[model samples]
Target: MSPRQTLTSLIVGLVLPSMAAVAAGKCERLVVTGSPDAPPYLWRDPQDPKHLMGANADLLKEAATQMGVKVELLFAGKRSQALEEVRSGRMDLLADTPLNTGELESLDFIHPPIAQNEIMVWTRVGHAQPFNSLAELSGHAGAMSEKTRVTPTFENTIKEHLTLAKQPNLTQAFQQLMLGQAEFVLAGRYAGLALTQTLGMSKDLQAQPLPVDTPGLYLALSFNSACNDPWLRGQLAKKMTELAASGRSSEAVARNLELWKAQLQQPASTPNQ
Candidate 1:
């Protein structure tokens, strides 16, 4: 072959593969899912039942906006279903993933978690007890929603040092506390407070000022996601860091907490008599 022809072929070979790599790495959009019942973090939009709306959803949107990407936060059944969707790569992101060692195999967690989940202790008003640390609840019988997840180490500590019951939902867990079936209910501060107001239990129950555990709330991408590339991850991490430093993360949380309250106050629709 001629030297000129061989050089031309080599140039084409390198350029084509480079172009393909760029195309493969492009991430224009992402599909996200998370706990549908986690309020102020995420919850199903009552008006638009198919999508999720709350602090985490809003914050993620803001981050994606900065990266010039469109994000859809959808409600995919329960929290377990949402996790599975991300794990299977059917969904690109999990908005409020807790740090889990086991999940490391299937997911890539972004650094500087988006938020800290304050798992507080809630007890009936008149029954309030001193709660400075998790160790204080050693003998007391506690309850928490089955869907709530703490760190694996914390879970092991609970098993070895605490007596806790897992209930179907936060309301049931709080009910157990109020009925004297359980001493205290462990739950996310905002999530528990939201339920208290909606259930009209705020007057009867109160959350302790101290949290039992504060776990990092992260944004994770599935290993199988088509858009799971270093460029996308770096952009998202940079956006998250900026949001945290700008105090916008706290503002989003406050806004969503109020938004959830207003949504609950809206009168339910009725059929014509």
Candidate 2:
């Protein structure tokens, strides 16, 4: 064969496959939904109404980039609305959800936990401890969100003492506690600390780390969505593990905590009010 013809054939062979691979990787934009109530976990920035930039938001943004996907944040009015969006295929990802049997039919959860949350009790600065043991919460009044899940003994015991309220979000739960409507409230340590600071209640409330329970938080994808992309999930999982191993994730968490502390020191102004 002539040298020019040989070179032309080789170029076509390489370019055609490259073009095919690029087309295959192209994905439709995805929407991630969460309520504005969960501050520092999944809350909107007051300064940027369209932007969500908390610890969980940062983590998910990193994960999506690593997975080669484009995502937009959809702030639901309530947690139930967010869940409904996911179930109906209106949303793609739901970060930081606990494993719930009811959701399994419509959702496929990622395997390893993206994060773990230490459930703790928050009370007024000088209030007596709500319960000495997980068993002790059986009869007392405590506030927990309708969507929160308490595992094992704590779950069963708290069921009786719980007062299900229509606060609809974590921010409202904190408000309920502040208004003396509930004896105690349950929240993740990192999340609760950040929210308390954001709400300017650090001096008015105290977080007492309880040994009641801890739950692994996972990333959830809707089964009904066209983008049920496990390959993307795998990429994100690997990147997250790398971030955790290199201590970058921890550093980010610490930096966010310091930022929250500084926010707490500022004069109180409600971000979403």
Candidate 3:
């Protein structure tokens, strides 16, 4: 072959394999999980309990799509169980979860977070009162989902000062407040709003205007994930950070709320296969 043709062929052989290696570094398949009842953020698909859907799901799907990866969102029972699945490496990705020690050890958290969750107080309609801060919550019984985690500062003090009840899930926590069994319930602002609508409890409860804590919700990658390579983590983090900074996450949240609103109106006629 001519020297020019030989040089071109040599360059193609070298460059193409490097490109292939870089592409192969990405995670091809991702199994993501999230809360089964937390809406706006994530929740089990009503028609298919084993699958999940919501804002976080939407964001993850788009991010995974951008990376040419396939995403499978599953519901592994309750929140704690879902977390355990991720921790145990049974799941590759956790779409919406908070930062904590246990998770920190087993997972690589992507930032900036997909969404900022502002937790607030919820009470029965007529029983609602001015709640400016957690200090104002003293002497009142508070309820929150057993799966929910509070900030270190809030937990340190709230644990010692308040009679906070941990219900099995969001529905139960809100139910406790509505039944007068608890004076106030702690939950996410958008999630709470979405829950009330979905559960048909909008007229029965009220959330205080002030937030208790503003925590960012992240997409966590399990340390043992099959797709937990540097390329996967870096790409996912970059996409998630863009979504967070560009307000795409917020827009997705608003869009997902409407999706949930529509889902709430649908009749349950289909079952998961």
The TM-score leader among the candidates is 1
Model 3 / residue 128 / CA error / Å? 7.4
RMSD of each: 4.1, 5.0, 4.1
Against the reference, the lDDT scores of all candidates come to 0.86, 0.68, 0.81
Candidate 2: worst-modelled 10 consecutive residues by lDDT: 264-273
Better of 1 and 2 by lDDT: 1
Clashing pairs in 1: none
RMSD of 2: 5.0
lDDT of candidate 3 over 1-273, digit per residue (tens): 999999999999999999998777767788889777667788788778789998889888888888889999999988788888988889988888877666688889887788778888888887746667777889888888865656667778777888898877787887777778989888878767877777788999888888888777788888888788888888888897778678888888899888777776678522110
Tens digits of lDDT, candidate 2, 159-184: 55564453555677878889988767
| Candidate 2: clashing pairs of residues | none
Candidate 3: residue 143 Cα off by (Å): 2.2
Candidate 1 local Cα displacement, residue 117, angstroms = 1.0
